[model samples]
Target: MVDARGLSCPMPVLMTQKAMKSKEDYYEVLVDNKTPCENVTRFAESQGYKVAVEEKNGEYLLKISK
Candidate 1:
């Protein structure tokens, strides 16, 4: 699991990419903003991972399943 809140754009996705590279199972990424969440989701999709996103309490929760 990775919490990317308070991080700027691309950083969150970069971190997420790293996390995914180190894991062979599912991963969860938490971001405070929407743009990062969208970018991460798109990246996950492009990598052949299943992506799920939910917005709650002004935060975004992104789940990636390989």
Candidate 2:
């Protein structure tokens, strides 16, 4: 899981990229705002992962899986 809460923009995307480098089948990215959530989801999907999003308490949890 990549905890990207309190982080912004490229930071969240960068963390997700690093985690993806591990070649894991699935990953979860957490972010507090819409921009990071959208950015991370886009990055994951562009990499061919299926992206699922859950919103709770104004935060977003993105589940990315092959």
Candidate 3:
């Protein structure tokens, strides 16, 4: 899991990017705000990942997979 909670836009996306370099089949990205969630979603999808977002208590969980 990429615990990006409390992080801002590019940091979250950048962290996710670094994780994705491992070439895994799945990733769980956690962010506390919508902007990071949305940015991560966009970046992941652009890389051919399927992103599914779940929200609870204002936190966003981005489930990214091939």
Candidate 4:
């Protein structure tokens, strides 16, 4: 899991990108706000990942999978 909950834009996406280097079948990204969730979803989808979102305690969890 990529814990990007307190992070801002680009950083979350960038970190997720770095994690993607491992080429796993699934990814979990945690962001505390909506923007990062949307941004990450966009970037992941652009990279051919299917993004599913879940929210809890004001935090967004992005599940990215191939």
Best by lDDT: 3
Candidate 3 CA-lDDT value = 0.96
Clashing pairs in 1: none
Q: What TM value does model 2 have?
A: 0.97
lDDT of 4 by residue, 1-66 (tens): 999989999899999999999999899999998888999999999999999999999999899999
As for candidate 3, its clashing pairs are none
**Candidate with the greatest TM-score versus the true structure:** 3
Between prediction 1 and prediction 4, the one with superior TM-score is 4
Q: Per-residue CA lDDT of candidate 3, range 1-66, in tens?
A: 999999998999999999999999999999999999999999999999999999999999999999
Residues 8-58, candidate 2: write the lDDT tens digits: 899999999999999999999999999999999889999999999999999
What global local distance difference test value does model 1 have? 0.89
* Superposition error at 18 for model 2 (Å): 0.3
Lowest-lDDT window of 10 residues in candidate 3? 1-10
TM-scores vs. true structure, each candidate: 0.92, 0.97, 0.98, 0.96
Worst lDDT 10-window in candidate 2 = 36-45
Displacement of residue 46 (Cα, Å) in model 3 is 0.5
In model 2, residue pairs whose N, Cα or C atoms come closer than 3 Å (at least 3 residues apart or on different chains), thus clashing, are none
Ranking by TM-score: 3, 2, 4, 1
State in Å the error of residue 32, model 3.
0.6
lDDT of 1 by residue, 10-62 (tens): 89989988887775779899999988988999989998899889889989999
How many residue pairs clash per model? 0, 0, 0, 0
TM value for model 4: 0.96
